[model samples]
Target: MTEGRKMRFAMVCSSNQNRSMEAHTLLKRHGLDVASYGTGAHVKLPGPSLHEPNVYEFGTPYKTMYEELRRKDPDLYKRNGILPMLKRNLAVKNAPQRWQDNAADGIFDVVMTFEERVFDMVIEDMNNREQKLMKAVLIINLEVKDNHEEAAAGAKVALELCKELEATDSWEDTIDDIVAKFEREQERRILYSISFY
Candidate 1:
């Protein structure tokens, strides 16, 4: 809550390979403390295809991602999810579980869900007070559909929503903007929430 103190953010995505990974990379580039994970546990790389019945081969390695992140900004890695790796390096058992539980037990200042279903899941877990104090931002995915125009339109809507959210101080304003935009666009929605605990 102090000025210049980085906010702790958790990004929950349907898959950690593409959209969520890009967002996480961007946020980290901007010097925010962010950790991202997929809803499904231990999802294999080269995920299922959208257009065809084949799996997509373009995927990133988790360990390589971690190491690359650490090398880029050690502090970000330290505050994000790298502490658990450090513990593991020291031969600590339950390092992953400990770090994960610490993260989930109200450690994150904000929780952002990238997909609508994941957003709904996060919303279902929130209490009244937490909901009131929290900030939920939806990052609508443009790549879901193959149409370039649709993707561009979806990205535009998302940018507008983000601007509206950034401009207003009231949660109602955020909610209204989201609902109105989504209703107008009638496209697939990906929602992310940030909670200050």
Candidate 2:
């Protein structure tokens, strides 16, 4: 929370593929220390269908998933850009790890989630580990649409909020406003199309 010290951040999503990874990649590139995780039991992504999604488990190496995907449907996998996303997932080494797995003291100064479910999961996990988890860590949820374009936009908003958090001396006053702004951004996005693709 102090301006002089580096703020550690953790971004969580359902699959750790789209949203959180986008935020994680950009935040790290901009010199913020960040890590990403997922609250899902397994990694599930849009693929053929709900019955046959790209399902992977935590601790399952990204390379394994990529190979499996390539073997299952090479053409479709290539068409959907899953290969690059897999590579990025592998680079980060975070696969749908449950929030409970990320629990630790002083591990994160700020924990941000891309969805309400994940935010609840993190809080529930933290509550269960009240003795071990850091009490001072700030948890914020910013709803992010699950798509490459939206994830990129969400990442920028996250970066802006992170910088603002660093500059502020009091979080109690600005925290609610920050969350409201994030919600407003989501609403404004729902009625518009910024995509060129």
Candidate 3:
């Protein structure tokens, strides 16, 4: 463990509904300091058809989204897993937060993104920011599918990564070793870069 406090973590994905929330819940349940965000213009969920999606602003409450989707099509939403996903999201956080909006709230030791696009956005955002703290942060991209099953599996892998990271006091010094071990064991390649707060 670190000398001062536990490491802080952030999980990011496209809409912050499925993948990020899944990992967020697992990390939080393990008593790790963690937060999750979405790198999207708006929160989106699947609707009755492929072309139409249920889109809401960033600050819309999960309960409100759940009720609206349920009201719109109780059977369809339930069958498609949107209702359950919203309920799980409600348990984790009140609303979906945009990554750019919340990036400056505080410093995080590690920021994990679920997709390559989100990873790129996070890196760009970090590079654009004025580094006030000079604190080093590791931004890792572990591509996870947006679906429920893949999210659950990805969350488990994320939790394992956190466990390995927390085992060392100086993560920056040992991150490469941890990543190499994880990749060898899990057969999943991890893309990582260092940024500043």
Of 1 and 3, the candidate ranking higher by lDDT: 3
Residue 78 in model 1: shift from native, Å? Answer: 29
Reference-based lDDT, each prediction: 0.42, 0.71, 0.90
Q: Please report the candidate that would top lDDT against the real structure.
A: 3
Residue pairs with colliding backbones in model 3 are none
TM-score of 2: 0.80
The order of the candidates by lDDT, greatest first, is: 3, 2, 1
Q: Output the number of the TM-score-best candidate.
A: 3
Q: Between the candidate structures 1 and 2, which one is better when assessed by lDDT?
A: 2
Tens-place lDDT digits, model 3, residues 76-138: 999988899899889988998888998556888889999999999999999999998899999
RMSD of each: 11.1, 7.0, 1.6
Candidate 2 has its poorest 10 consecutive residues by lDDT at 188-197
How do all models score by TM-score?
0.44, 0.80, 0.96
lDDT of 2 by residue, 77-130 (tens): 778878777877678663445556764424677788877887787777766664
Question: What are the runs in model 2 whose C-alpha is more than 4 Å off?
Answer: 1-4, 94-96, 104-106, 132-134, 169-197
